[model samples]
Target chain A: MSVYTPLNEEQIIEILSNYSIGKSGVVDGIKEGITNSNYFLKTSVSEYVLTIFEDDNVNLDFCLNYMEHLARKSIPCPQPIQTNSNDSYILYDKKKLAIFSKLKGQTVSNAKITNEMCSQVGKVLAQMHMYSEDFKKNFSGVRNRDWFLNTYNKVQGELNKENASLLDEEIKRYLNYDCKELPTGIIHSDLFRDNVMFQKNTLTGVLDFYYACNGYFIYDLAITVNDWCTNSTFKIDHDKQKSLIGAYEQVRRLKNIEKKEWNTMLRFASLRFWLSRLNDQLFPTDGDLTTVLDPDHFKNILKDRKNYSDKLE
Target chain B: MSVYTPLNEEQIIEILSNYSIGKSGVVDGIKEGITNSNYFLKTSVSEYVLTIFEDDNVNLDFCLNYMEHLARKSIPCPQPIQTNSNDSYILYDKKKLAIFSKLKGQTVSNAKITNEMCSQVGKVLAQMHMYSEDFKKNFSGVRNRDWFLNTYNKVQGELNKENASLLDEEIKRYLNYDCKELPTGIIHSDLFRDNVMFQKNTLTGVLDFYYACNGYFIYDLAITVNDWCTNSTFKIDHDKQKSLIGAYEQVRRLKNIEKKEWNTMLRFASLRFWLSRLNDQLFPTDGDLTTVLDPDHFKNILKDRKNYSDKLE
Candidate 1:
């Protein structure tokens, strides 16, 4: 977690002038989220997270309205705080800015994810998917299969023979597969452990919806499982995986196709992250702070998923 | 602002079990302080700052007792939170950990420091000095004259001819001069603008006392003035300086010696920072995150202080 933009108190005060919230108090930079610069803006009245979107192409309406829509359905998400003019977003320094009411609960790491917590996360994921069915706005998944193939092609030369072949095979498999034929809906495409918050056995908040897009529901589940159920050694914690899937089924049962293609979805999820991380390493972003995650971790996960395919069933 | 230690929720829960601060809810890593691993711990009962002292020889008792002593005198400082065993500090993972009641208000940037704020800061600083007179512990200033000379010698080779001459001259001047004659007390050796917090019209918190040590109170004032009264180009803001000194006099008037040696003290402050920054650059620390502050900023300040010595009078 790192703050990119160093916004002073005056700038923060000026930004808050558009909103009806009282004078800002302690504006502490939250170095937690990776995608954007977040400040925990504690004003005299209430606490809110003021996020300045780093990527210019981040769909403001889709992210903000989706959160607002979820709040309307009594879901636990960071409801976007509105301005005096009823606008959900503000233009600060020509960048899109939005304030979200501070969500309760702490983000649990993968090591601390209990069976009950996994179940709670799964239930919340199912609920999020179910409630957002009527969300009219559509945003394309930036990290789709095409992105996977493209990123893989750029980084394949850097890999050794075995790793290169694994990536090549995965890319070819996804390129030929018709993902459009599966169940299509809004998906929280990147529901990593850090994106969700937990208090005891209950899930209190789901966050970082910038990656939310119109995608296959099973693919979203695969993404969640890949993150939440994986150990440090890249092996799946079978209990956690079972709890997550079992609870998800209680809310919205998996179709026959999803059940049959579960192993493929897992491999697809692993490959997407592997390629993304590899791309990041091969072509690093220019910034004040750049944390290129270890691509080898995902490589190990993909290899394990492929070699232990029957066991995954 | 960055967090070095990555403590999980389980470790946090175990740490909280030692204290009487109810149940810990959301523990967010505070990436503000440089010397310590601080967490903005929010529990069901209240919010507190849990600081794990990174350095082994941090003079835990001296710091904790001094803060506790100031708090007892109703000074606006964070009171150290005590444990069930009546100990202020906890030995966790071989690191000394202590919690303090979270202070109110936000730190003012240099641009946001108004005249009224300066006066308030001065008064509070004098109050701190006045209240801390009875504190028995004496931690030597780690950034003393000896540190400056030693650090300068190591980094002098890296500097150009002009910068080297400047360093040599300053080192010679400070070495020949007698600083032991000044009024010695517990000084907040590094009270930059960011260390002091303010609300609408009053100073609410004085934080980061890790640099507190036995040194000239006037030197501390000089350090504060040098930082708080300097503009973007390192020139002194006369009105702000006057305001700070004027309010400080109301509480604890400066001695004639201090008034006469004010310019020298200002140079001393500038030289100390310049040497430290230069040394850090030349001899880098081995760590995951080491923020080497620009030495050129302090170099400019020192040069300006030396050249404009007549005007400073």
Candidate 2:
């Protein structure tokens, strides 16, 4: 038995029928998640994914449109299939459902993430950011400070005196700091290594667009570096960081201010995860199979950010 | 003006009047947390803290008893103030609350933590573990894994695919691993640097007993190492790690089995925070002031654990 809600074959076929590109044949539910429902649909022609939105309020239409936009721009993303009515998404039994052409590849684990794969992931993220120029008009997601503060506040009750004080100071700093305005567009807010698919060093597709939003392009790069470039111990691999940043900068030239804010961005990015995890530790959900992340993991990151605050200059 | 409900001076005083501690001059509320409410109280003799439980359902009585036990054993902790009924806790307006003699010191921030301070933290944690042998019988506080998994399952609906998979795998690994069960006692599940007070590198007191529970002694050490020994980038400092472990071993000898499970324990410790943060990122509470930790931070830790897992063997 699955910890989360299980999707039946009928539901999968019903959802896949909306997508015009793929025919529904053998629908095999993939054990990819403990939270949401995912099925791999193998039609006579090709393989595709059928996903049902676990949260009804999550904007699936915007996600489908974003995926379509990325696919059109030559970004390696799963393209959503149009329904019989030619709609990209379907509202079935009060749940938002969509089908997409599954990219041919595998989710790369840490052991499988080679230096070459790291560079490829970095380059692909850069390309996605470069092509995200008009993303705001199409889809506008949460910004940096708002997102951080909102998430932080959720776990505010769990925080002890020092952490609460540190959080207050950090929030004040971010609010007072004059964030330089830059180009705004769609960003893959949660583009960690597992979300990106690869086949022997070749980038095949990028998955998990749930966190996609309109924010500073540099924020996306920071998220990628924080996710893909850093080792398990939260230590940055200097070579990998250089390679990833080099690839990103080659595609989209960061402005002087963006470059200057990179370190703070990194710090902010690290703080982002720390605060989120702390909240979960305080108030957990039902049927979720994952462990609560340690709030201390980001304490080190916060400390590092304080030390290297001037290093980015 | 606060995001949470504010307790007035009279209400706070009324709640503390029942406690057997010396009458202290009460100050306004200093901080309000998810788990407890904090008030700074000063008496003619000394200063103390007035902590009110926010959640009545959680084991407030157990935590207070544990603190009292540690204090009797000459452990440095905030001694609990007894109520008028000679009970350690009181119910005011349906909220559970406790009072304690406050310890004075500053939290060890990244700017403040030193090599010596790290060692002291380790020593204190080891001592607390040794002293907590009778924790379960004396005080009935909650355990770590149950608290973690329970909350994770609650918000399972909001999690994305990759996060869910990671959570499932981690929970399974922890269950399957044959940990050398040492003295089952009260372990401070969260002994981060911020939780420990420091007066010039001498450990003043260990605070935040909300997460105190019955578990393996080494798990507490793992939590300490995970919190105190890492650098800014979340990487473990080799010297700091050695110093921390060395200090801990000096206080409580590490059996060979405990040493063997050290790496796995560390990885498990890292996962604890990672899952918690991921859940917070997905679901947040209302009117909270703290920042949500970034889920990516733990993703980095999880990756590092994959590399460090072999080092343990």
Candidate 3:
């Protein structure tokens, strides 16, 4: 999450010309993401966020448009600001250019993740699912089941035998996930604690909708739980999971099929991310911004998800 | 005036809706101003300064438009951002709202005023004087000659006779200043160290256009020299004054008339701020934001200006 594309004042002003928003007075790099260069834009009127996509793969049409749709429906997320010409994005130096209304609050550090916070996140996540029910756009994440197995194969030779076999074993077990039989809707494919912003333990906004896609509702819940409900030792905190899922159910309850598929969804969530992180480590991008996230943390969670049958109750 | 008007998040958002700058993620009140409410806004792309004029008398047309004009000529001044409707300023809750591009440096503290800095301030001030040559719009400050004398009479009863007499004597001396003879132009009337920003001993930006007005070129130079050249003892640092004036004349040479009137202008420069600050002290506004500035610092400088006839060479 470092600045890969640094912009000057004139460049920033040119970008602001596409909209009626005020101009920036000062700008500093926000060091947190791997895909894009982000700057905090402050004007005399209000504050905003500028996202300059460094990668060609940024799905502005789906992700930003989805955020626009969700924000209009009263979901607590960053709304993509349309350009004065009414486009969700503009091309800047052949890269995706867009700004979003900055959300209130901040992401809680992992150590500070509490059950109450989880409950709030779960509530928001549930509301998001229900709110976007009418949004017909479908998206499949780049790091899905196929990516999991493919990434494992790519990084298999680089890993120790134990870790390699552990990866293969998990991939095989959940390889036959029957998505057609389960309830499905749009899912924020990446709902890690860092993607959520909170004010005084109350979740104020969900951020970084880059990985959002159409998927099993249980999949989103699983991905969220694997991050927020996990303890320091990589085991699920029963109280936190209960708090999260309990609050989620208050907004949109899980179906019977979803309940039966809970543990598998949890396993797949960990397996996919574990493989992805391992792949990134093995084939790291050539940049200073490539923050090598830990792979083994999710590996541990992958194994723990298969410990006993997860009871939704 | 301090933050006489404290705005909450919703009020800030409502104000931002008028223009298209991205919304702020975090806004913190800037603590170093006297006539308006200012905030440093940080969003995702850039930074900006928000000024809400607390006084009903703020001249947005002359001050903002003047800054807009000066900024175009590449003078180190903040340019005002216009609304989508192309208005110079928007009325927020009936108070003037305008955003400016944040300048690059910070105001050099009085203790850190360097000769190099005074030279830079001099060059920029001279450039500003020359650059706005075509800008025909004029602004007369309410804290002008008439206000100074009227305010003196208003505060006469509050003073302990000694301070009052010193003010009256200075006023009577400058009361007959022949404005027709002096070369008049737009002057940044308050070029105090706090109003000029510097980075690494170089002046980067001149701020607070609220006090900018049509006035004598020597008057602006006198104000600049008195503040920049003054020492801790409130006596003029001759070397600093020389550096400032030397750099200034390199851009716009002083006429014989301006050179002859320099000391009188210095005393008047000190006299105006002295009277204004005294009036503020005697009749402090009814708010926690009315930071009491000492009137005697300028008074001491006024006495010192009368000690020696200032020379342009």
Please tell me which predicted candidate would have the highest TM-score against the true structure. 3
Candidate 3, lDDT over the whole model: 0.76
- Lowest summed-lDDT stretch of 10 residues in model 1 chain B? B68-77
Query: Clash pairs of candidate 1?
Result: A1-A31
DockQ of each: 0.01, 0.01, 0.02
The C-alpha stretches of model 3 lying farther than 4 A from their native spots are A1-313, B1-6, B288-290
Q: Each candidate: RMSD to true structure?
A: 21.3, 30.7, 12.6
Per-candidate iRMS values, in order, are 18.6, 32.2, 15.6
lDDT of 2 at B152: 66
User: Which candidate leads the pack in DockQ?
Assistant: 3
Evaluated on chain B only, candidate 1 has a TM-score of 0.94
Q: Per-residue alpha-carbon lDDT of model 2 for B1-313, expressed as tens digits?
A: 1344565667655764664233335555764344456777653323567666665556666777777656543356776654545566677777776667667577665455677887777777776765554344543345455666686677566767977787778777876766546555678888986678876566778888877877777777877887777766777777888787777766667777787777787788888878777666776655453667687776666657657762331
**lDDT (Cα, tens digit) per residue for candidate 3, span B1-313:** 5555566778777776665444433577888887788887653323567788777776778887787656533455766655556566788877788866677778875557777888888888887776556566887776677787688779888887888788778888878767588888888888888888876675678898888888899999998888888888888899998889888876777888899888899999999888888888877777634568899899889988888776665
Report fnat in order of the candidates: 0.00, 0.00, 0.00
Q: What are the per-residue Cα lDDT tens digits for candidate 2 across A1-313? A: 1344555667656655554332346666676653456777665334568776676545677877777655543456777765555567778787767767677678875555567776777777766775455344454554356766777667666678998887887776766766648665778877877688876567878998877877777778777777777766667767787777776665556788788788877876777777777766777776553566687877777766667653332
TM-score of each: 0.50, 0.47, 0.51
